[model samples]
Target: MSRYFLIRIGQSLLAIWGIVTIVFVVTRMLGDPAVLLLPLGTPDSQIQELRSSLGLERPMIVQYLDFLRHAAVGDFGLSYQSFRPAMEVVLERMPATAILTASSLALGAVLGAATGFAAALARGRFLEFVVMCLALAGQATPVFWLGILLVLFFAVELGWFPTGGWDGPASLVLPTMALGIFVAANITRLFRSSMIETLSEDYIRTARAKGLMPRTIFMVHAARNALIPVVTMLALLAAELLGGSAVTETVFSWPGVGRLLVQAIDSKDFPVIQAGVFLIATIFVGVNFLVDLLYTLLDPRIRLGR
Candidate 1:
């Protein structure tokens, strides 16, 4: 188990390195930072001075090394637009993104898992058909479009929720629902399929032959087996939730790391962009690692390598 954990940790480090190198190289290879940084009408000599001040005049290798050193110390530099440290801005906004991700995952998992289990047990019943239809519609629908429609219905027409902002708990409702519903839909499909498979296994039949109660069989035997795939999918989805937060946050004008990232991109703020990218990548790697560890805990065979 310890060895497996170390393996995951090593993989996470490699992922972080790959992300850092790619972002660093790609951003630097783009058009001159000075051209974007300086005033449009600034004299060429002044632009050169500005570049020198920002250490942009140095060779690419030296610049990358400096960035690495500063990044190691949490000095991700300052956003050109906000004139604040990139880390500071990201830190301030992170809670909103965290809240959004947590809410989406919690709601999606519970709802999806329950719906899936119920549908799978129903098999060929009307409820199963209806659940499948909803799943298809959800999978086909894009999140942004859903968000817009929800805002139009709930906020614009009914005025049950505010259209945008992270001003209060009430303002979080629409965006959370918009993001979570699609996630729930997908999870439902996964859970239903996994559960159906588990139910058909001979072990389930054995339990039934042993006179196990239906509820006991479901809660103890089938549910644990069904949850494995769900956990895997949930981990992968966490990365998406964090990365996709940008679109949801933008649509709702929520003060989150995603929105901050968009603002950085629009202004070509390298520091903020880099910080957000690194943070998002780290989250992906971190969650994936945690998932691997959890799998072993959930299934003894995993730890024992059965």
Candidate 2:
């Protein structure tokens, strides 16, 4: 078990390093932000001075090595725009992103589980067909488009909720729905499939033959077994939700780290961009690691194998 945990931790750290390295390289390739910081007709000498001050004049390899060294200690440098510590800016927005991620996950999981169970129980019926169709449509739809439609209908046409902002819980409704719809659709399909398989197993048949009620057979026997795979899916879904929030946050103008990253990209703010990507990658990787540990509790085979 100790070895298993060590391996998982090593793998997660490697994944974070790879992702952060990629983002660091990509952000640098987006052009020198120092040039953008100056006036349109600023002297070339002044621009060069600015670049030198910002340390962009250094060789790419040297810059990358320096970044990695500082990053190892959680120092991601300063935000070129806000002049604040880059990670500090990112962390300041973490609460909003965390709220959005948690709310969306909870909403999606509950809806998906309920609809999936219903679809499985009502297989070959109208409810099953309708649920499946909706799930497929939800899966196929792009999150940005969904967010726009939500804004159009709810915030524009009917005015039930605010279009964007972090004013209150009311402001969260649209973005949460936009980000969570795909999660719900995915879980619905997976849970429905698992439930169907569980229902077909001998234990379920025996329970039915022994005069077990429908609810009892499903809640006690089928749902519990069906949830094992879904637990894994939930972890993956959480990572997806966090990644997908970039588009959702941009579209809705939410002041989360995702939106901050978008702004950083537009301005080519290397520190903020790198910090944002690194922080998010670390979080999702850590979430997956924790979920893997949770799986051992759910299934003894995992610990035994370890």
Candidate 3:
């Protein structure tokens, strides 16, 4: 088990390195930051001076190596926009993003698992049809569009909640829903299928034959196995939510790491952008690592160190 964990840790570190490198290279490709940073009509001399100061004047290979060196020690320099440590700025927004991610995941996983299990049991019934249709619609809708629609209806027209801002609990609703609805829809489909398959297995039939209560047979024998796939899906869903939060937060004006990254990109804030990507990637990899540990609990037959 220790060896397996070490191997996974190495792979995760490698993945983070790859993601950071790709983002670093791609960000440079979006054009020189010095040009975007300086005011329009600024003198070329000033722009050149800024570039030199920022080390943008260096060769790309040199800059990348320097970046990697500092990044290993949790330094990404200062934000071009805020003139503060980039990681600090990103971390300040971390709690907000953490709230959003947790709320969204909880909403999605609980609702999806329940609805999916119910749908599986109610297969061939009207309830199943309704759930499936809603799931389809949820999956089909884009996060940004849903956020807009939610803002329009729930905030603009009805005034049930604030359209944007992170004032209190009410502010979290729209963005969470926008990010979570898709997660729920996907999980619903996957879980429903897994449940149906699990229910048909020989062990399930044996439990049924042993005079186990119907509820016990379903909950104990079927639900646990069905949950394994949902657990895997949840890890992937978390990554999607992190990605989608950028759009959702922008639309809703929710202050989060996602929104911070967008602002960094708009202002050509390279350090903040790099820092944000690194933080998000690290969180994602960590989540996947935890999910790997969870597999043992979900399915005892599976061993980790094999």
Candidate 4:
């Protein structure tokens, strides 16, 4: 077990390195941000001066090395627009993003689990059909468009929820729902499939034949085993959610890293963009590691290679 864990840790570190390299290259290849420092018709000499001042004159490899060095010391350079440290700007907005992500994932888990259980339990019935319909609709809708429509109906027309900004919890309702509903739908479908398989297993059959109640059959014999895949899905969703907030956060004007990312793109703030991607990638890697740890707890057979 120790050997397996150590090998997995090395693999994870390699994965992180690969991701960082890809992100770095992609960000630089997008276009030179030095355009921001140039005037409408600036002389070539002045452009060169500004580029050298910002260190854009260096070879790409040298620039990357400098970035790594400063990043190791927690610098992350400066924002193109405000000139504040990129890390500081991202850190300032981290709370709102964290809140939104957690609430949305929690909302997804509840809706997903309930709907999944209901769909599986009510298979071949009206409840199953309705659940399927909801899942279909959830899969079909684009979250940003849903967010806009929701804001229009609830905030503009009906005066129910606020249109944008994170003034209070009241402001979070519509945006969180918009971001989470689809995730819940996907989770529900995955959960339903896993549950159905688990319910048909030999252990479940034995429990049912022994006259155990439905609750006991599910909870005691099947539910925990069925949940392993769902846990992996939820972890992946959490990772994607961090990166995906760009669309939702922009639509709702939430003060989060997602919104910052959009602003950074507009200003060609490469440092912030790189940092944001790395931050999200780190979260994803961390979640997967935890999920691996959870494997042994969920099933001893997993630890024993059964």
Candidate 4 segments exceeding 4 Å error: 304-306
Ranked by TM-score from best down, the candidates are 3, 1, 4, 2
Model 1 poorest ten-residue lDDT run: 297-306
| Least well predicted 10-residue stretch by lDDT in candidate 2 | 297-306
Q: What is the lDDT of candidate 2?
A: 0.88
Candidate ranking under lDDT, highest first, comes to 3, 2, 1, 4
Cα misplacement distance, residue 49 of candidate 1 (Å): 1.4
Residue 122 lDDT (model 3):
99
Best by TM-score: 3
Report lDDT (CA) for all predictions: 0.85, 0.88, 0.90, 0.84
Stretches off by above 4 angstroms in model 3 are 242-244
**For candidate 1, lDDT tens digit of each residue in 271-300?**
888888888888899888778778877776
TM-scores of the models, in the order given: 0.94, 0.94, 0.96, 0.94
Write the number of the candidate with greater lDDT, choosing between 1 and 3.
3
Superior candidate under lDDT, 2 versus 4: 2
Badly placed stretches (over 4 Å) of model 1 are: 304-306
lDDT value for candidate 1? 0.85
- Between prediction 1 and prediction 4, the one with superior lDDT is 1
Per-residue lDDT over 25-57 for candidate 4, one digit per residue giving the tens place of the 0 to 100 score: 888877777777566888878878877878889
> Once model 2 is optimally superposed onto the true structure by TM-score, how far is the C-alpha of residue 269 displaced, in angstroms?
0.4
The residue pairs that clash in candidate 4, if any, are none
Q: Select the stronger candidate by TM-score from 1 and 2.
A: 1
